[model samples]
Target: MASNRPAESTSFAPSGTQTIGFASRTDEGPWEEWNPTEDSVRPVRGRHRVTKQRGGGLARSSTVLGVGVMAAVGAGGMATAQTGKPPVSISLPDLSSVTDSAKALIGEEQASAPKGSATVLSTAGVSTTEAAAGTKNAGEALRARIMQQAESQQDRIAAEAAKAAEAAAAKKAAAAAAKAQDAARTKAAAEKKAAEAEARKKAEAARLAELAKQFALPTSSYTLTSRFGDAGAMWSSGYHTGLDFAAPTGTLIKAVHSGTITQAGWAGSYGYRTVLTLDDGTELWFCHQSSISVTVGQKVSTGDVIGRVGATGNVTGPHLHLEVHPNGGATGIDPMAWLQSKGLNP
Candidate 1:
């Protein structure tokens, strides 16, 4: 858009012929002479040259502080990084007392920035030495706790095993004791039985000896002329029925066994005879006796004189006829065999 208000004009005064003019159509035809030339349009050199401005002290100091903040984070200081507090709000560490990388970073920051001024970034990042010490302490405490637990568990297991072993040993000892006790009881019982058997055997032997002392023979100092069971036709039954003891007349004849005299008088064909009946109903016949000393029904002991030997019956010489009737049987056992059976080989 064109402005319609007053055009701005400059008031000027000319020195000699200075004037302002407008070009007509004739003058506008070829104005090559008015074109600019190189030398005439060239820029001119001036005396003044641009210089750099001085920067503010605050800006440089701020830059140095920023560097210090980053250095605190990398310097391994406890007041920075892992402290969790704002870096500027954290306590400023004593540079002289700081150790390892923290001391080095503090020195650099002192040279670059201001004295006694430092930033805390992260303690985990910057406080290398203290952080490692804390980690090691924690690991050691944990290891000690684990070792204690393991030892306690081992002790408990060992105690249990020892208790079980003791129990087993006690059980074994009890069994052994019981076995020994049973063995002793059994041995005692066997010994008692043997002792009783020996006592009974000795008692039986004493009784048999006493019985042997009580038995006796009918007569002594007599010659055996005939034995029982000898074939003969002179007596009844056609056999020698009694043992014949050849002796002189009036030789003593005693009771062969303990008995009572049942007959003490003359018997037909036997002359003066005596019959001794024993306790078991066995009769002992003493025939051809000259006389009888024991009366009838008189009790006699073994080796008691009851009669005298004489040849009064159907005999060829003076002798004693002794016959045995077992249980009152007509036949009797051989006297020699009977005597041998009683442990007397007659």
Candidate 2:
């Protein structure tokens, strides 16, 4: 078995007093107790020589302690494997002491290092600070760009909306203008139609007025007793075929127009009658007259006294019956209408 005690020193030492430097034994003094210290010991040479180190020798001591701990853990593991035994727990020294020693060594190493190496470390720190500032500036720039883009998009949208509104307003205005134009055209057409109608009416009046100058009433101071187509038992036909003008006896009758007398002194039921033929071959008949003043085949002008009004054959009072025949036909038309055509109201 290996002993845990330290091995005894093999160095030689004198147990009692000895002669100094080959002197006589009578000159020797009494011997005293001897104590050994570091100052009293002499340094060894070769590989065992002890050299002084800086940092109060803590660096070397700490290095030896770390190596010894690693060796001890490795030996323990080997023993456990070889002997088939459980691993023993090892008690480690305080880590704080090792840490302080390592700090002290680092401080001495930096102090002895060159200026260029220290500059490199300082430059690295500055670069780190610059990189952080650059990151922050980049973030701010990006935010600003995003805001500007958003504002531009919003402005574009607003412009488009305004453009749309303007387009709608223009369209509405165009439609309103078109509607007004249509209304104006309609009003103009109506006014044109009315003007044309009025012009035609005036032209007709002028034509009738010219005809009135060439025609005259057959008798005056008379009242209309009957009209053509009047139904009565006093006439031979079922309806009256001529217009009647009631007046006092001896009322002078006049020629209706420039015409030649065709018949006078009527016979039968007609007490007095006269027939006049115009240039157009239209015949005018004056019946129930009191007297006849014009002769047959005699030419007369308008307003010439032709006869007088009186009660004649088949007559109930002094009245003149007038008839008109176009182209001397057997049938006659209404004298009132024929007179109105000559522009004479009566």
Candidate 3:
């Protein structure tokens, strides 16, 4: 360590009255005083010029020299073990140039750097940046995977719901169809029964109407001598062919029921015959009449006087031969039972 001690001062008189003092690191005690008379400041040969005590160049140069010596000592220590030669060292008097260049590099980095996430990555180290990028990528991938799985699950659930809805709809449709079919069947059966009942009623009405048109005995005084199925030698078929009404020939032959006279004339076997046809296609034959007051196609009312009783055809004398034909067929029915069907006992 160098001692910070003040040395002896020297005085110099440059003009008649101007005075200057100087001090140094080394001093001998015999101080000198002199007058310096010079026109300009100058340097001595082989030495640097000394100026006033301003502490400008000398201080700066000394600082540079001390840094250089320290760099040299450190380099020599670093090189001594392997090689006898010392490593080279260079020192700058002012480090502002290198620091300015470093600042320029930082500015360029700032100017050309990316913004947002990329800007953060440039300042960070390699391991830190890589780890951050990997973490971000992993997070994004995991989110994407979760979204895809969610979409798949949603699609599966939607498909299942659709299938269930379709099944329910089909089941409802089937049940409705079955119910409709049952209703239709029941309706059809009821209609069939009603139609059958109506048809039977119509048939019965028509049968009664036909029976009313037949020539039955007006009074119960007549008797049945010739039945429809009695075997007889007088008939052409060797059987009794007509229903007989054995009344006196002159007895009033009232109209059997409401009808039109289809024929009223002298027929060969059934002389003075009268055929009356009812509306429902039944025919009444009155034969062996002494007189016929009705003509063909003549309309008549029930109980009206149509003819007089007579034995005009192949029959017993002074009797009426009467027969009933359904739709004008050859065969005849029993007069007694046929008249009874119309609520009349004969």
Model 1 ranges off by over 4 Å:
1-208
- Note the Cα lDDT for every prediction shown: 0.72, 0.79, 0.68
- Global CA lDDT of candidate 3, please? 0.68
Highest lDDT: give the candidate number: 2
Clashes of each: 12, 0, 2
Residue range 128-193, candidate 1, lDDT tens digits: 355556767877999999999999999999999999999999999999999999999999999999
Kindly list the per-residue Cα lDDT of model 3 for residues 1-346, writing each as its tens digit. Answer: 8988898774552233433266343323344564565633453444333232343544433433344344434554321235557865554344433344434443454566565433222122323355456767977999999999999999999999999999999999999999999999999999999999999989977887676665345433576677778997888889876667677657888777788999999998788988988777878888888898889989987787788888887775666776778888877877656666774555
Provide TM-scores for the models.
0.40, 0.54, 0.38
Candidate 3 — which pairs collide? 249-309, 249-310
Model 2 has a clash total of 0
Per-residue lDDT of candidate 2, residues 161-278 (tens digit) = 9999999999999999999999999999999999999998888789889988999998889999899999988788888999999999999999999989999996667678899999
